[model samples]
Target: MASAAEQLAANMNFQAFAKATELHKRIWFTLIAMVVYRLGCFIPIPGIDIAAFSQAFQGQAGGILGMFNMFSGGAVERMAVFALNVMPYISASIIVQLLGSIYPPWEKLRKEGGEAGRKQLNQYTRYLTVVLALFQSFGIAVSLSSSPGIVDNPGPFFIISTVVILTGGTMFLMWLGEQITSRGVGNGVSLIIFAGIVAVLPRYVIQAFELTRTGGMNGGVLFMIVVLAVAVTVAIVFMERSQRRLLVQYPKRQVGNRMFGGDTSFLPLKINTSGVIPPIFASSLLLLPATVMGFAASGNLPAWAESWLPGMVGQLQHGQPLFMVLYGALIVFFCFFYTSVVFNPEDTAENLRKYGGFLPGIRPGKRTAEYLDYVLTRLTVIGAAYIAAVCLLPEALIGFAGVQFYLGGTSILIVVSVTMDTVTQIQSHLLAHQYEGLIKKSKLRGGRGR
Candidate 1:
């Protein structure tokens, strides 16, 4: 059966896509939406001095704000309307997920309710996104104006205009992402980040070339960086595809005097059950202090606050020992946290038992749940370590080499993971089309062992 499927996939062509009009439409729509999003990133917000803001960001590179600016595709540096990007939405979604795990009402809504409940939760998340966006926008506006010569006229009008424009931009980006998810080929949020990373790649490469030209960086080190990037990409691909297969056996049953259900299947558990989220969450948390400090540093705050805060913030800078350790710990913590939120071994066990399925070596109830949990825990540990290494290593290397390139492990992971997911979806579509072709051919042949 697998070989047949593989053959079918091999035979798939543009003809299949031509027949799949709906999927084609979706793919086109998604592309168009993404193009629009990229255009929006270039649209500068009104009433901000672009040159001054850019200069401020230059001084603040290696700080948290620069990281945020990178994620937003330089919108933050340009102080574009979409400076907030979809970060507020992501933050709100995380908050809702965390709350759903702890809050009974939200938990019940997640489990007992159906589409209606989901819609309600989504509405709530959107509302929260708007709130977060507004707050962040206000903070950002104040931060920018605090910078000397950033705002020519720092007053209520400038603040209000900036806040409104940023808020609107964020909501627009959020809407664009949702549209892509519903009408496009891949995840909208991920694609946005992928686009941002890809956009920045050329700049990083150029910077590396400049450094080498100036004799600031060794050619050997540049070669090593390239080789290391390729190696990390390969490793990420391997780890992301690695899985633990849990063997399940079904007892034979009589159906209309014929034996059935005596089949076995393996439940595949991914090594990294929580993909990308751990590092993203960890980075956001670790960078929070630096972000605040960056803003505060722009302000004429109390002497004690400025003195003590920047020093503390320096400790959390990208290559600092404290920063790496805390970042790795947070990645591990969120790996476990997000995995538990997304997967419930108890629920899986119950569903399997209800379907007359049992693990090969475990009892069908509590024991199976315990077994699954144990397996997941071990897998999560490995997954967390993989994430930590992939994420922390790049920063450490860049820091040790004293290179100014901006590419990092987290960016590479997102790019690779999203690319793989997109390819898998495309393959699935092709396989389905191939199956449809087989069915049509068999119908034409009319039995007799085609």
Candidate 2:
């Protein structure tokens, strides 16, 4: 049997959507914003030889650059203005999140202060983003200049110009994301990333077929890859929705003329408390070496370091044992690290105590905190293993096939998670629209009676 809410949702149709003016407006705005972002991906940065860079990029496509390129909607390959994309912003956020845990003042601001503090933190992130962007942009400029034929004119002027352009581009993208978040549906940053990943799907499909036609990949392998992607997506959905629910009981109380009652509820903790962040953080950290090397390798390397550098980089290739081990280790580290930052067992216990609520058989203050932490630690171990497996399995396939299917499991996880979140938001908006219509009809009926 369906609940009333479920029944209402089932009954929703074109008529309901047509009635939702705000939803229509938001949908249109989101589409337009996405289109704008896509257009930006093609606007090439000046003073770079596109043809040469494209050819050079092909050689590096099997490595870390491929992953970043996919996330940037091929902007990096195209050497577009948005080539840097929102990666600097993401790096800044990671830094800020880490600081919140270790730095006393930042930790206090994050935990104790509310909305205003968050706004302040966001400001700090933006400033840090500019700094990261400039550093990355300078490296890119230097790399391009050093790489033969990649830059038409290589000098101090080109370096300065490239850094300025890329920094401005990244900042513009950051501002655009903020606007979308404030006025549109879903999370702005995630949606931008989602759009970038989706934008390259057609190209990936074409590439897969091209490989098959060229006899580089057989039909069986292609089919297997397709099946693998579907299986991974299904697994991710199940794991993401899985939760541990802890029962809480409120004691019965008596007021002078009324009875205030006992109520039972559950605190739901998601299996993946860290969400898609662990892989993103891990990948970004791993990518730094490759990305920096790609941008700097063409530049004059010291005679002493040249021999070992290339071999060291080769060892870190995506699917190699060394890379896999480090990737998995980083994912596990960030899983616990991020989960602890966001969810404090002590704070949860304090809030429960303040509200006269207690977990079944547990004291409300320190004891409750201890109990929660114990459960959380166990859950996190399992969650870390799950995330590590999901993120690494795709990378391992790189050795057997040209399965450049969005670089690795991290990209797939991101695409699927963002899609799920967007759909959820749309459903929520539709439900709100239905409520508005019901309220309007009630007001009209009352007026008629009056």
Candidate 3:
């Protein structure tokens, strides 16, 4: 049987959506912002030779450059102004967070400075973003200048111009993301990436169909691909929603003349406590050097960069042994590190103690904290393996199937997680709207009875 709230939610219809004025505005704003972003993807940067860039894109489409192009909504292929996207911001954010964990002063500021501290940290991230963009843009500019026919006029002037244009584009995207988050709905940065990935999905579907029609792809093969994709999506949805709930009991209490307090509840510790953040952070880190190298050398490595250690960035190629090992390692590392950053067992334990709540059969404070940490560590191990497997399998398929699709493991996670989050927000808005209407009706009835 469904609960009353569940029943009410199910009963909601399009009429209720129409009545939700605020939600309507948010939806429109989000749509408009995304449109604006997509438009920028078509606007070329000042000095790119579009013909040469297009040709170059075809050869390097399977490399890291292809991944960048996918995330940029094909902006990189066009050498569009928004080609850099908000990747620098993401990379900078990762660096800042890593620093916060390791550096005492930064950690103290985050722990003690409250909301103001967070603002300060954001400011630091923006500064770092600019620095990173400058370096990356310069690398890209130089790489383009060195490559024949890639740059319209290969010189200092063109290099300077490219750097300035690319850096400014990334900064603009950063601001636009903040705007969407504050004025619209869902996470702005993730939505931007989501939009980029989804925009090219139709083309992939068409490509698959064309191959089938031409007898290049067998009908059975196409069906298998569809089945695999659906199965992966279902698995992702299940993993994203799975949680480990610990029972928490509050003691019965009497307050003066009234009786109160004996209620049991659950403290839901998610299987993936960091949500989609770990993959995004790990991808950003892995891609940072790859992006620089792609633009700096365009897959033809200089001797210095080619000197191989185990898992060198220059040696990275999807489905290769070194690439798979490095990718899995980074995913696991970020999963544990990010989970620790976002959730503290100690803090949870302290909060529970303050509220007179305790886990069943466990003592409060230190012992509870220890138990929570133990459970979380075990969960994290499972979560890390799950994320790595999900991510690696798709990339491996790229090499095995010989398909040119760019629906990466990380991209799928972001798209699904963001969609789920946005849908939840919309549902919450609708439920709130229904409650407001009921209140107004009750007030009118009371006035008539008066």
Candidate 4:
């Protein structure tokens, strides 16, 4: 049977949406913000030779740069101001989150300081973002300088300007994302990334079709890829929605002849508690060494280094056995690690016990914690395997098929997950609007009765 909320959602119509003025405002704000981001993707940075850079970028388009370009909405390809996109911000946020668990002071703030602490940590993340952006932008400028014809004026001025422009662009994006989160719909950073990917998705699709038409790719292979993509999307949705519910019973209590409690609830645990983090982390780690080696090999390295770097990079290519194995192993490792960080069985057990709730036929304290940990461990195993399969299979197939587009499992996961989150937020807003309408109607009736 469908829940009341689900039924209400099903019955929601255009009329109800029309009445949600706040939601309308938020939607408009998000759209405008995304438009601004896309526009920035086209505005190239200063002092870069556009034609030279484009030619050089195309040569390395099948490698890591291609993946980054896709995420940046072709900003990287254009060497745009937003070439860094929100990646530095994302890395900073991840670093902050991991530190919050390990660092004693930050962990205290995270656990006890509440809202104020969160703001402080966000400030820390922003600072870290600026640092990382500066570092990355400097590296990029140096790399471009090394590649002849890419930098128009290869000097200190050029490097300084490149670093400032790219870092400033990243900071601006970070601020824009914060605005979206406060006044718009969905998470600002995620929506920005989502917009970037969706914006270029059509071109990728058209390219696929063009490849099929030009006889560069077999028609049957194209069809298989399309089918595979759709299948993976379906699997993503299903697994994302799947949950394991643990029943918790609250015993009845009597106080002054008033009975309370005596209720049952199920704690819902998602099949994939870690979400898209594992795949993203795994891919980033796996690609970093390859990217560095590729860049080094292109530069004026010594004969020994040059000879070995290219071979190492070749071995680490997408479909290679070493790459695939490392990718899968990293994904599995991060899945378990992140899950452990996010969900603490002992804390959950303590909370349940404090609230006088207990799992049926189980003790309410330490034993409950053990049971929860055991269940979560089993769930993580399945979750890890599912994530590995989803990410690796399509990647291997695409690499083998010589597909140029970087439409891998991570992209699919991000698109599906972000879409689902945005839709859910919209529905919640609609529900809130409906509830407000009901309250207004009831008050009007009461006023008239009086």
Q: Which stretches of candidate 3 lie over 4 Å from their true place?
A: 1-8, 212-221, 294-315, 438-450
* Ten-residue stretch with the least lDDT total in model 3: 306-315
Quick one: RMSD of model 3?
2.7
Q: Looking at candidate 2, what is the lDDT of residue 417?
A: 84
Instruction: List per-prediction Cα lDDT, in the order shown.
Output: 0.83, 0.85, 0.83, 0.86
Q: Tens digits of per-residue lDDT for model 1 on 1-450?
A: 577977877777888867876777877887788778778888987777788878877877775556676777777777777788888888888888888888999989988777877888899999999998898888887876666787888878888998999999889888888887777877888788777777777877888888999998999889988888999999999999999998899999998979998889999999999988887777666555667766675567796697677677677666778778887898999999999978999999999999999998799999999999999999999999999999889879977987766678888898899889877877787688678878988888886565
Which pairs of residues have clashing backbones in candidate 2?
Answer: none
- Candidate 3 Cα deviation (angstroms), residue 267: 1.2
Give the runs in model 2 whose Cα sits over 4 Å from its true position: 1-12, 401-407, 438-450
TM-score per candidate, chains pooled: 0.94, 0.93, 0.92, 0.94
What lDDT is reached at residue 65 by model 4? Answer: 62
- Cα error, candidate 1, residue 56 (Å): 1.1
Top-lDDT structure, candidate number: 4
Better of 3 and 4 by lDDT: 4
Name the lDDT value of residue 135 in candidate 1. Answer: 89
> Per-prediction RMSD in angstroms?
2.3, 2.2, 2.7, 2.1
Q: Candidate 1: what lDDT?
A: 0.83
Off by over 4 Å in 1: 1-7, 438-450
Ordered by lDDT, highest first, the candidates read: 4, 2, 3, 1
